[model samples]
Target: MPSTTPAPSDDQSPASRALADAVREIEHHVATAGWDAPVRVFALVRTQAALDAEPSLAAQLSPETLAAAQAQSWHLTSIEQEGLPQAPDLETLLAGLSWPATVDGVAVTAERVVLPPAAEAQMPSDPDEALPWLLAHPDRQDVRLAVGVLREGSTWCAVRTRANDSDDQVGQGPDVVPGLVSALRATLA
Candidate 1:
């Protein structure tokens, strides 16, 4: 269930290269682990300049390619229905943050800031009140966002659940929880 954000090849233009590299990288990762299970991954690739010039393209497929190139470009979108979670859409209000840690066995970083169920569900009413405990971990990032560590039965799943929103924007909530957990095993490796 391992997935990737592939990168375009070097021989292509910087824009195309970025695209290919993202793809290749993801493909390589999945292949290395010999994953046959379905996995969801979202990747955005654009040259620094291209993104600077046309920011909307960040979530768009290139429009200039021939049929074959376009087909390759659409691979990610095509496979999106396979049920992998898409990364949260870019938000101008939230600064992207990456913090290293292992929740359960998967070692990865998350941007959503949250607290453990005890502190979040039982403790003080003030949001800032949880700061000391939430920020206590040296590995935790200092951001004005909620972080979460999902514990389903025995394993823990850490992620940044969206702020001010109960609806999960990424990953499976309950229906695909098992698959998501399986996918994490590969990510941890």
Candidate 2:
């Protein structure tokens, strides 16, 4: 499906703008390449120091929150739906988010790929090792895959299709990516 860019008149927060831009870019790519599956999403996080380095976020913080200095801020930056192949690199994209220092949590929604039990059994137990193999697999072509990862190690993935009012497919837990999330977590670990 072709995804629409969030209108500029929508919420104008920095996060919303960033997400909108990402969606726009991804949708463009999908339009040309074909959106055989659903959209995928990933989360980005920033450290308190990283947020402090940005001037725009200064007004978003309070003296109390600044004094209490947390290790990380929880704001999500969306990656283009191309998964790992989107430009600027995931680490670089996350670093550029510039979220407010006061923020400390992020939530992500994404399309997911669920492997068949037999396919899952064939995957490597190690995430770092599995990632490359998974990316190169022919079977992956058959399913849509999206992943969301938090700095705190929490991860979720969506899979298949469910009826929804919107053009997008929404995925929930229990039916999402179990083995893939595990592998992704292992890579993070």
Candidate 3:
């Protein structure tokens, strides 16, 4: 007997809608990558104030959620905040983070990687010096940031996915190098 259970409607909730949409987009983008493991998408709220006042109706989140909240909204703010590490580098910056977390009773895991200080220092100062290497790395749906260290100091940048494979690239609209450069600049600042 074919029981006709209606599919879930899109009007679940504002936060759920956003979360579901984000998840779908992430899944679609991640599909081409050959990953047997499950990769969950989350939003990281940076400030304590943001964490406290998080939109209750926004969506389920994880420790990784802190980064998204930390991202600059506009192009100018993004560029102005160059050298400042964004959510993608949160895990890398903090080396001891575990896989799963409990947030408001919801459990989630963030698949992320961090570049060590030494590796960061080796990054090419000119985007051209480093862009090709950046393009050659893996295609991951998780946050990707460049962490660098100079003789005087260190820095970080968010590596966009598109610089390499045109088809599977993510976050290509804006110039990812600037934010990455900003993080590097700030680290050395």
Candidate 4:
């Protein structure tokens, strides 16, 4: 079954919902470049806070964006982190990172090949050798995971399968990938 983002639950605070929105925006933006993409990262900042830091930015920001920021106390702007070093270990990359106070939160979008439980029996036990097996596994589902984390510990996750293939099919919630979520949270610590 395809995954889709549901309406925010009643318990979601405005800040949490805004983080979700930023995560969704990052997810959709990454999806536009297609699948099998590299690990893309972003820094989320409150829109008004950004403008406060640099009034000159007002000219660059659109009226609609400014309006949305004013409409809700939760609006955020996602700024992409370009030129990330190529690393085989995502956790390693994240471990070496830390965000400044100016950054309200951090987000990352990455693709993974998910294999069925039955297919796991044929996999190599060696972590180093698993990449080739995972790549060759025909029963695998290519899924992209977009995760965002706030310094206050709030988190949002979005997942989209290559099979489903659409923005509407994106599934979202908190901590979809627990391990990755933890790593992202550490960046804001």
Candidate 5:
């Protein structure tokens, strides 16, 4: 699905704008498949660079994807990673990853159950007991955190909560979810 991402402001750096577009695009892409989807990862690269590397991909992409990619000079193309290994947490999954030189950046989307600060204080201390507590929380919100980081350190995040779910409602900024941004940066480092 095409995203309704806004053009980054004039004050923003080129890297920041591109990463914002790429991350938001991935957020909408995953949203199209519905909620509760598995963690999805992607290798980000310049659209022209990717086409140069693999000409056959031109034939594989949909007409819209191809035209939009080629039309924008700074457009980023996301290559979704498949067969991801199971991991207990986002940190663990990312700690084991490293991208190749060809990849300009990376992006990942994961679903999380979020709650207000007050709700966290009532949670169980034990991991085993925490599952039920989290699941049964009355104020729980389902959120998708889509974070992207460039090898040069630019970052962008898109956050969507099920309660106010809509492409237009997705929040976008550099630190909307800082912890996830840092984790994504670690993978690039």
Candidate 6:
């Protein structure tokens, strides 16, 4: 005798659905604008006026954080670029960088390195110290990674840089880059 049960689907979860939607949105924007465009970054803002203008977004807003009368700002880097860093000069731009006071969050689509738990555990407490380790790690060779973060503690990342390249290679979820994301988040915190 055998039981009749359907296997779960990947997009069945709310989080999964959100990721799918976000990736699609980014892809559509890139396709419409052309592939050779430079990476663009936008500021995420939240305000009572915005909430009032779009009642639907009220559900997405953090009530506790928005209790004040002022507007809040966050940073979102476009993930539409064909590759990480976007421009040749981007590496120089990111070096020894300090975000502005108005930016409470950061979201970028640059290539990132996803480390194993053992590797993550070895990361230094200081981001400056950990940076060298991340750059020199043997596993980081020929890998593609992307990360996104929200000030409210929402983080997502993806990895797929091997021979088997496909749409699915751009995986996304909160489970990626706890250490690295935390380090980046700390900068803005």
Candidate 1 lDDT tens digits, 124-159: 567687666555743442211111111222222222
lDDT of each: 0.31, 0.41, 0.32, 0.87, 0.85, 0.45
Q: How well is each residue in 26-145 modelled by candidate 4, as lDDT tens digits?
A: 999899999878888899999998988898988988999999988887789999998887676788889888889999999999888889898988899998888888888889899999
Each model's backbone clash number: 21, 3, 20, 1, 0, 1
What are the TM-scores, per candidate, against the unseen true structure? Answer: 0.24, 0.36, 0.22, 0.92, 0.89, 0.41
What range of 10 consecutive residues in model 3 has the weakest lDDT sum?
73-82
Residue-by-residue lDDT tens digits, candidate 5, 19-94 = 8878888999899999998888999988877888899988987888788777765678899999887898878999
How would you encode candidate 3's per-residue C-alpha lDDT over 23-42 as one tens digit per residue?
A: 33343445446334342323
| CA error at residue 124 for candidate 4, angstroms | 1.2
Give model 1's TM-score versus the native structure: 0.24
Question: Which 10 residues in a row give candidate 2 its minimum summed lDDT?
Answer: 101-110
Best by TM-score: 4
lDDT measured at residue 1 in model 6 versus the true structure, 0 to 100: 8
Residue 137, candidate 5: alpha-carbon lDDT = 88
Candidate with top lDDT is 4
Clashing pairs in model 4? 3-169
lDDT of 6: 0.45
Give RMSD to native, each candidate.
17.1, 11.8, 16.7, 1.7, 3.1, 11.4
Tens-digit lDDT string for candidate 6 (21-67): 44334533433443334544322233444555666765764665455
Error of 5 at 166 (Å): 1.1
By TM-score rank, best first, the candidates go 4, 5, 6, 2, 1, 3
lDDT of 2 at 24: 35
- Please give the RMSD of candidate 1 to the true structure: 17.1
Model 5 weakest lDDT span, ten residues long: 1-10
lDDT of 2 by residue, 1-189 (tens): 222222334444443333333333333333344345433333343425435567566466576544433521333333332334443443333333432323322322333344557777899989899878777766553434444434354444333332231235333332145655554444343
